[model samples]
Target: MTDWAHHRFTANDLLLDRQLVDSRGMMAGRIDDLELSDPEPDPAGGGSAARAPVLTALLCGPIAYGPRLGGRLGTWWAATGRRLRGDGDGYPCRIPLSLVARVDRMQVRLTSPRELLPSYRLRAWVADKVIAPLPGSGR
Candidate 1:
């Protein structure tokens, strides 16, 4: 691995679609979207020192991936994700930036294990409900 260093990054160019590996070297997921920190409100209301929005979290799962896929398929994918989640809030699996230990060209490494992430439950559910019963799945 190359020496990790902080550098200016383009979200779309550098982050989008990058695979995420957990601390235990497990595949977590690919970065599908980002949640940015809202800039702090200026106390003076003068708009002179408005803080720039910063990255807050990395998002994954079909809910975050659908839009990027675009068109009808993307729409359907997102809808299906929301349906499976069974929630009105519809937020995807959020991996906070604080958990990210390293970011390289091919993957973003996390300080936590994949099983520690909420996405793990979703994947487990899919495996149990969708995949296990399929023919030749060998589950």
Candidate 2:
């Protein structure tokens, strides 16, 4: 694996709210939150571990975005997403860090296709149940 520790970009400046594009150049979603792994203890006898807390996944969806917004409305928005999901777990969609191909000033590009992402569940649901049923939606 390439050593991401050597990379100099700040996560907050480069990743937060950046658009995520799949390998097919399809828009998946904006990065709403980053999931970092806890530092693991080193087995080589030093007090410090070889790996520190590292970015593990990208979280996308209202559940992730709402906490960042931090207000009553944000809470409501997140709750609505949870209700729609009906999973009782309320966790936001997580895209593994391994799928990230590159990060630029405007967006983060993925190594996977957009259709494989869990983040598109709501959009797909709406399209199938609502948009597809419209009179002129080309059904």
For each candidate, the alpha-carbon lDDT, in order, equals 0.83, 0.83
TM-scores, all models, native as reference: 0.79, 0.82
* lDDT of model number 2: 0.83
Which pairs of residues have clashing backbones in candidate 1?
A: none
lDDT tens digits by residue: candidate 2, 4-107: 43257877878888899999998888998998875564677465555677778999999998888888989998998788778887888899888888877777
lDDT of 1 by residue, 47-124 (tens): 434577778888999999999999999999999988988766689889988888888777889898888887787888
Error of 2 at 95 (Å): 0.7
Best by TM-score: 2
Q: Which ten residues in a row have the lowest lDDT in candidate 2?
A: 1-10
lDDT of 2 at 130: 93
